[model samples]
Target: MRRRFAVLLAALALAGCSRLVETDQARLCRMALPALSPPDSTIEVVGQHEFPDGRGLRVVYQLEPPSPALTHFADCRFRQPGRPLRSDELTTLAIDGRPLSDVNLYFLVRFWLATPEARDADPAPLGDVADLPRLPRSAAYALQQALNGLPLAAIYALLAAAYSLVYGLVGRINLAFGDFAAAGGYAAALGALLAVGQTPATILAAALTLGGAAAAMWGIATSRWVFYPLRGATGQQALVASVGLAMAIDEFLRLAQGNRPVWVSPMLNAPFGVARAGDFVVTSALDALLSGGFALLAGLTLLAAMRFTRFGRRWRAYSDDPLAAQLFGVSPRAILAQTFALAGAFAGLSGFVMTIYYGSVGYAAATGLGLKALVAAILGGVGSIPGALLGGFLVGAFEAAWQACFSVDYRDVAVFSLLAITLALKPGGLFGVRS
Candidate 1:
């Protein structure tokens, strides 16, 4: 606690001293589009250019006399080609000789929609003023993009941490972890659905208990039946076995549910206004509150399991050395079963969250969830629980951020890049000790 406090104090001091300062500046020039001869052209001729910040620009010419033939005049949509414009954020505005209504205008400004302080400090145009417009990537813009992902990143981190614990103790990258999480979310949804008019407390308590128990059962079954016999097999064989288990579970779910994506009622769903920061958007009241609660519970549960319980101690002993642990009269099989059950309970709980809060779930839900959690575990340093959680969040946040800036299709790229970079720089992950 003292160390954390000291670090917090230092961070506060640094924040207090930090200010937005522009390291360099360049000229920003505008391009004028040629007048349109045919006023009724279906396509508005907009010139595309970029700023030093790599922001895209569009230039539209307005006709002096508004033409009735042109029904759709393009407006100044300040964004680069192939980039999705964020709602309410400022982009470049173009001034052209064409009638504002007749010719729709657009410009790609490479400037980031940063905080007022940041904008005020670095108002200089980026790049040389030239006839043709120029665009470049901005450090400020990239930083802002990164910040936008922090909240979701935080949530993913929490999941990763929880997953790491199971991995550390079980030494099996339980493919079902994501499924269990999905189950938790579904259970929460089911509970809420059944208790529509009940008080919030009753709904939450009942849902958690029922859902959690169900998940626990799932975990126990997996450990006792599937994973135990494969213990003597090499890690590679175990990996294959896990894959088979995942396929079987998914198929069972598919048979039961028919492969439809189901939506669950979020126990707490309220749309609140989010304050937009430089590039990052802050979470609203409910998002922040729920995320905080989940994080706290996950952390405490992990600590309690590791530090206070006999089972936990035995689990640790087993994790360290199963042979030694068995000599001490610890039943490795029993412990393994228990651990799987516990992990499954967590997954079920996650299912509730995913279905209710996130509003989506399907039989194959674990496919992505399991892989990402695995990545998170590995990134955080496999065999390290906290590391798993941290890795999960990092992967989640990065995926979110990358999707926001680029295409959602690029989400995989973002995760893989992080994985590669982490492996290259710190093979053990952010939390794992040097191997």
Candidate 2:
């Protein structure tokens, strides 16, 4: 608490000294589309180019609503800065990349001139200086989005591995892992309620810790009490039980926390430019790095333990032949309990990531996540650890690329299509051994 208070005080002191110092490029924003500022209009700067003189600016902007054609791209060019543009200086005004007539350019400028700020700021809004903001990333948008997709990829990898871990051990799918992730979110929320006035970083850290602990405990209990009883049962029986468990968990949380979604305060979201393409820059935030790094460490730790530890050997031996493992005095019940608990912990971490990444966690929202993780597992080879990781990365990359390059409405369609193609072409998955 004291540490958080001290940090808060320091941040406030820093903020008090900061001011909105506009960039040279932002000076161009106003001229690029003063059509942006009046009442209901929304502006998004999509691309920018600077002439050799540096004073000459050309940009592409997307304007929404009240705009002539509803979310159409428009182009603007200015030959001289720091003063109102002359008739010859307003070089181009185009819609959808087709240059409009000089009369249309004058008309748009006239519309901006009607605004109160433009009128107050300049005697001649058409001939006076104006601006909006920094010319942000254009070509770098895809790179930035791809970079952002990594944390989500890590989360999916963790969830996919959880699916693989249980499937390899028991030969039965535990569909409740996604629900377990939601349970972890609930645990985080409960912890957040107790942590008053703490910094966002501290809150996130605490949430993760509490979430993992609670989830591991529940996983252990469920495996021992619910799954253990079904030792000799068929796969469908266990699968149905898993679905029931998921529903019970969802309902329990809905009843416990109410129907409204639990919102998480966003943190560490100040983007810092990291790379550039042309004049466009790519940016990332500290939270992404922190979360992604943590997930990587967790994944590496799990892989190492599974590959080199006595537990790993025991697990592999049991997976190969449970009867032989029992003859060797290995308790099947103990192994099942431990494996499920580990899987639960990973799922919990995944849930924590999802909540923080999206800024909220919902009671029944994780069903899709679980289903997707299952697909990721199958796509990579259901029982293969490394395959799970690869599948998750591929899925995340696919979604990010599709969303960046094409319409977002079809992103899911693309993912499901990939799954269908993979299943049809390679039933055992990329890494799965032929049965």
Candidate 3:
């Protein structure tokens, strides 16, 4: 068991390390701080400090000799408000009464701004912008990113649940599940094109119906043709077939849709600021909210049905022991088909909402999206609905937070690394029962 676990960790580490290849100096500089130094210049972070209220951070950095001239007078830039560093805010560090090479800069970065309403109503204006009560950018940015992660997490959760449900029922992984999502996305895009100039409600209805139907059809076809015949076969045989089906589906999609991304114009484009803390502003996109809400509603409904309905009990019985279920007059084939249909519907709904939120879909994105959902399922504990939700949120937040702090290229590496660590510690997942 120990050796096997070690091998698993090594494999995961290699998977993550493969992407962390040597990057260009310019790219590295951008990942560090493009605002402070040129690509050729050497810059080192010496010290850092955060305000008690979490409104800002002060970064002290040392620059090598022959450094580029500082164009901006201020040490810090307010990214949210798009404000340049002011002359009054500049601070130069000196060593033993001698000025350091070029500029030894200390940055006081503020994240939040005074409310617009308060600013407008202030009878006595502050002399300097620094005098205005500001909110810490770190807190605000973190909050904003956390909120942003919700919709993505919700999508992941839905897909993860689907994967879990299928796996629990059949004891075989459906590698082609992501392709079902891609099918749904394509269907939604087609529906959008066909429903052009229609009301938002009509467009949404059409897209959902088309996308869900496409996914349901695909699921039914696969279960009946590929899986049903191999029902008595080994798990390895079923897995191989699923993988082949995934590749075939991917190729078919590429051939049918071409390589270009299909764009889906959102029905409602009105986005307004939903929350503000200091200078950090959080905008609520209609599609994101709708997607998150739909996922939550769908998940809750499914849980309720599983706990309360006769079909749910029968499904659970079949999942636990198909032979026993058959002995009790429950047809495993019918239940399995229904399970596939339900899983496909969930995947389809996710794809439809994701396309609407993102405004675009690509044939190639299916694999990554599906894999992430699988990761979420594994992280939460395979076959656990609530666990899937937790895993989805964690994955989403992990990605969002990493992107906010570092380069986007490393986001996947970070996610996989975290997964590897989590699995290493808890092989059964966060909520899975240990055998």
Clashes of each: 51, 4, 7
- Clash number for candidate 1: 51
**Candidate 2: which stretches are off by over 4 Å?**
1-141, 199-201
Candidate 1 per-residue lDDT, tens place, 1-435, comes to 466357445643432233211111111221212222343333332222323333333333233335543322222433342223242233433344233332232222222222333343321222212222122335434444554554455545545654665667655566666666665655665675565444445655666676678677777877778788877777777778777777777777678666677654343332222223343333233433455456557667876887789988998898888899999998978988877776676666556545544556676767777666667777889778767766766676677567767888878767767777877898888777666
As for lDDT, the candidate ahead, 1 or 2, is: 2
How do these models rank on lDDT, best leading?
A: 2, 3, 1
TM-score of model 3 vs. true structure? 0.68
Off by over 4 Å in 1: 1-155, 158-162, 273-283, 433-435
Q: Better model by TM-score, 1 or 2?
A: 2
- In order of appearance, the predictions have TM-scores of 0.62, 0.68, 0.68
RMSD to the native, candidate 2? 14.6
Residue 165's lDDT in candidate 3 = 80
* Residue 324 CA displacement from its true place in model 2, Å: 1.3
Candidate 3's residue-wise lDDT over 124-214, tens digit each? 1211223222447776677778767877888788888888888778777897888888899899888866765454566677788988889
lDDT for residue 332 in candidate 1, whole number 0-100: 73
lDDT: worst 10-residue window of model 3: 20-29
